[model samples]
Structure formats: C-alpha cells, structure tokens
Target: MTTATTTAPPVLHLAGISHTYSGQRRRTTVLRDVEYTFERGTFYTILGPSGSGKTTLLSLASGLDTPTRGSIAFNGQDLSHLGLGRYRNKHAATIFQQYNLLTYMTALQNVTTAMEITGAKPATGSRKARALQLLGDIGLDKAMATRNVMQLSGGQQQRVAIARALACDVDILFADEPTGNLDEGTAQGIIDTFSDLAHQQDKCVVVVTHSQRLAAQSDRVLNLRKGKLTEQANTP
Candidate 1:
C-alpha cells in the first residue's frame, strides 16, 4: 500500500482581484473580481485589446501597483503581508520590452548590477560566474556580454535583460511585450528562450502581449477583456 503526496500550492494566486481609478467627476473600474492561479513549469500568455487593462494586471502581479480590492499571494503568502519591496527583490523578476538596461553599463555589468540590487543570497551561487553562465545560457557569447548594452543589437540587448532577470534566481518570470520591437526571426528566438526557461528551467513564465503567435506557442492562452480572464481553446 502506498500513500499519495499532495503537491504544493501555486506560485501565484489572485483572489477576486480588482482595481479602479476615482476621479473628481466619476470612478472608473479597470479590473473586476479576477481570479487566477499561476503554477510552476508553465508558460501562460495574457492577450487583450488596447486599453483592456493588460498592463495594469501585470503591474499588480509584479507588485509595482496594488489592487483596490482583493489580494494576491505568492507561495501561499499574501503579497501585501510579505511586503512588495521584499517580494520584488527576492521573489520575482520582470523582463520588459524596452530592455531597461543601464545605458552606462556593459551587458555583464547590467546583469551584475541587478543581482547586486536584489542582494541575491550566496546560496543561489556566485554573482559573477552566475551572471556569465546565465548570459551564455540565453545565447549571448562572452564578447557580446562585455559590450555596452547600447552597442548591442536589439536581440542581444533583450537576451542580456533576460539573463539579468534569471540572475535573480526567482521562481516566477513576468514579461511585457518582450518581443514587440524585434524582427520575426529575433522575436522567435526570444520566445524560444522564454519557453526554455519555463519548460526546462521550471520557472513560471507569464507574458502579456498582443502577438497571437506568442499566445499560440504558450502552454495556455488567456484572454483578458474588460477585466476578466478566459482560457482560450487552441485553434485547430
């Protein structure tokens, strides 16, 4: 006789999440009682039309902003109680379309700086070796890593950004329009990198994008409309 063990809870749980803006004339609601759970080892895509509050959801999820109602928890701990700063520093990392790399620093330095800010524990491994290894993992050669971010191609810069995020060694990765500015080939490469990170590295990957191609490649496609999330069936 054998007993079955229960799996751990989701990495991220959104409970009745809602947000709104109050103006002198009136109030506008952006999100309406949204519920979602994002688990590890999966890549999920959130798609929506313009002004549909996609960025707002990402902001709240990343702790860049708070919801007007409801709560979000990571690893069964409320984000509010865990503290947004600590959560951002120690629990998750985001990759943005703009790359957002420090213009003054080389690619390696950019990653090194991010790890330093997060104060990544030594338990995760050595900062220098880890940064170099991460950059290599994402297809950036040592020569590219040594160049200033401004000197690298868009695709190269994005890879450095991804490396920086991974250097944090967080369980969850959030991306916003990551391939928006890249060419078709470059975009596909970036998408592939994300997929590898989710499937092989076991990082919970969530991307907010308008690209249907991206959604198609994801393990799950979620449509966000007027503040609600609906799972989309795979098109035949």
Candidate 2:
C-alpha cells in the first residue's frame, strides 16, 4: 500500500495587492502590486519610512481592512470569501501601535475579554487563569493586572495589549511598532516573545517596526519602499 502526503498552504498570502486613500480633491496610492507569502513558524519584520504604508499592508493582511485592488488569502482561501470579521476573530490577532485597550476594563479584563470574544479557551485551566498567566508573562503582575488600563503607564498598557493578543491564541499575529513605548529591556523581551510565538508555537508572526535590532532577530526581513515591498537578504 502507498500513502500520500499533503503539505499545508501558506498561512497568509497577498497577491498583487494595492491600496489607496481617497480624499475630497485627490487620491493617494500607498501600495502597488505587493505580493507576499507568509508561512507558519516564521517571524517577519517589515521596515519602512514613516509614509511607506507599512500599516496599510499590515491592516490588509490582518483583515482590519481590504486592499483597493487585488486580493488577500488565508490558508489558500480568499479573505473575501472567508469573511473579514470572522477571519479577524477566529484566525488573526493584531497589536496596534496605539495599544487599543478597553478603557473601562482592567488589564486582566482586557485580556480575558479578548479571549472571550475570540472564543479562545484554555486547555488546562479557566480563561481567567490563562489571562493572568499571559499578563504575568508579559511582565504585568497581579497588582498591575487588576488596575484599570488607564492607570497604567504607556509601556504597561502596551504589555496589556500584547497579553490580550496572546490570549486570543490565533493562527497569525500582527504587531505595529510594538516596542515603541517600551524600555530597552522590555522591548527585547517582547521581541523574544514574538520569536517564540513563531518558532515554538508555529504561529505566523508579522511585525512592522523601524527598529533594526528587532528586525535583525526575525527570520525574514521585508522592506517597503516607494510603494513596493521587497525582501532583503538575511544578515548576521
């Protein structure tokens, strides 16, 4: 008897995707024919200048927005057919640069609420247990976790955002300038967490950052320039 082996499709794919912002008098195009394939168990960092549209690309890939032209797919299925809201809730999690936490909730509440909304359940414990653990892992202790997010500092709130995303237990993780508000040590720890998510957990981790130190640790380095996305050779 002979057995057949099947390979899984890429976690996320962008095919000739372009995006533009239309205004009252004129339209501005940010991306042009951007094609990329992101696979599981890999960490990717996108480098670009302030106006290079890295956020737009991340937004499209994370299902927060659709491209102006072309298409995006997850696991070989087009996002259009997959339903953007469903994709975002069930498959992808994003850590916005602004740390979009629920203002009325505590740090722990923020994480647990995300897990609840995403329908993520822990294998061995209650959702509260998992949320607390994830928050602690990101350096927020029980005291900080119990406090409202507004009471926390910017770096602390950023950690809460990261914990919320981690608790979602999604397939793809997207982060934008995640370390911008952190100190050096904390920033490095977050980078390590991202690396572990990709290599250890087999998740597709994509981060948009201007930090070369963070980019150097990623498995792949992508650069967005002049409305084009290109990969740079890995450097030591």
Candidate 3:
C-alpha cells in the first residue's frame, strides 16, 4: 500500500507570471516568468531599483491585473478563475505610497469606505468604530481619526491608509512603497506595525520597498531584478 502525501496550499502563489505592454513604437516587458509563495503569518518584502516591475508584481498578486502567461492562486483557487473584483475585495487589500485617501474625508471615513466597499456586514457607526479602532491600533488617536486627511502629515496619512487596508479584514495586504515619503523613525514605526500585523494578527503582508531597513524587518525578502525573483539571504 502506498501512502498519499499532501502538500499545503500557499496562502498566495505566483507561478511563471509574465506581463508586457505594447505601445505604438515598442513593446516593453515588465515582469518575466516570476514565481513565489507567501504563507500566512509571514511578512515579505520585495526589493528592487526603480522600473523593476515591483508595483506590477504586487498588482498582479492582488488580482488587480491578469498575468500574460501564468497563474496566481489563493488557497488553491486560481485568481483568473475567480471574480477578480470580489477576489480582491475579500482576499486582499492594497496600500500605495500616495495614501490614496480622499482629502476631504476623515481618517475614519476613509477606512469605513473600504469596509463598505468590501461588503463587510456592519452598521455605518459600527464600521466607523472599527475603523477608529484600527487607526488606534496603528498608533493613531481618536482625534486624528476625526480630522480630515489633508490636515494630517504625510506619515499620518500613510498610517491612515494602513488602517483603511486593515479595515477590510483581508487575508493578504499588498503595500507599494508604503514608507517612501516618511522619515526614518516614522518609517520604522510603520514597519513595526506591519510586523505586528503578520505575526500577531496572522496576516500575510507583502511590501514592495527599496529601503534596507524595511527589508530587514520582514520575515523574508524577495529581490526582483528585471522582473526575475530571488530570495535574499539576510532577511530576519
């Protein structure tokens, strides 16, 4: 008799993903045959120079775009086979360097909007409360939660973006240059928040960053060069 061996499904998987864009004059390949896996409760940082397809890779992993020649799977389900919008809403959330919050909206409003968009089952007030709670968790206070995003500093705005991402309660968080605009101390604080999210909250956190400090804080570091991926050795 032969015993069957089962392999665990990755929380997120990318297999041979490739992407290209065609313009009138030339075609440019952004990602090339990339493959990686992210498990729950782990923080991964993808590091590379500018124009290295880091953001493109994050978009594809988050189901924002379809791969040209490969597959992305979430818990054994193919991303292409699922409803991409619903998949993104339920399984992943993205934070960008720009914060992407409405300038006129309060921090709580920004987070609640994400929760509403994701179809989370909570009353508006409850959602706001949860949003505020998340903001507090990320080191923001209630006063900041009620203030307009434009009134906040850059680091504060980025913290709000992180709170908004967490509001959706998705299994995976995709962040693109989340600390690009902050100072060293503030950036370190943000990295600590991400670490807590992955270790304490059991979330899979993937960040595309160029900062060595941020890479050092992650559970694993993936280096992307000209769209290819390799694991870095010095990750914590």
Model 2 bad stretches (over 4 Å): 1-5
> Each candidate: what lDDT?
0.87, 0.96, 0.89
Candidate 3: tens digits of C-alpha lDDT, residues 1-236: 99999987999999898999888999899999998889999999999999999999999999988988899999988987777887898999999877889888999899989988997745456887888888987678999899999999988899899889878888999999998877777678778888988999899999999888888889999999998988997665
Model 1 CA lDDT for position 215: 90
Q: Which residue window of length 10 is worst by lDDT in model 1?
A: 120-129
**By lDDT: ranked, best first:** 2, 3, 1
TM-score winner among the candidates?
2
Model 1 Cα shift for residue 206 (angstroms): 0.3
Sort by TM-score, top down from the best: 2, 3, 1
> lDDT value for candidate 2?
0.96
Clashing pairs in 2: none
lDDT of model number 3: 0.89
In the range 1-236, model 1's lDDT, one tens digit per residue, is: 99999989899999999999899999889899989999898999999998898888998998888999999999999999999999899888998778889999999999999999998744556787788888887678888888999999887888888788878878888988888766787678778978887999888999999998999899988889998977787722
Q: Model 3: clashing residue pairs? A: none
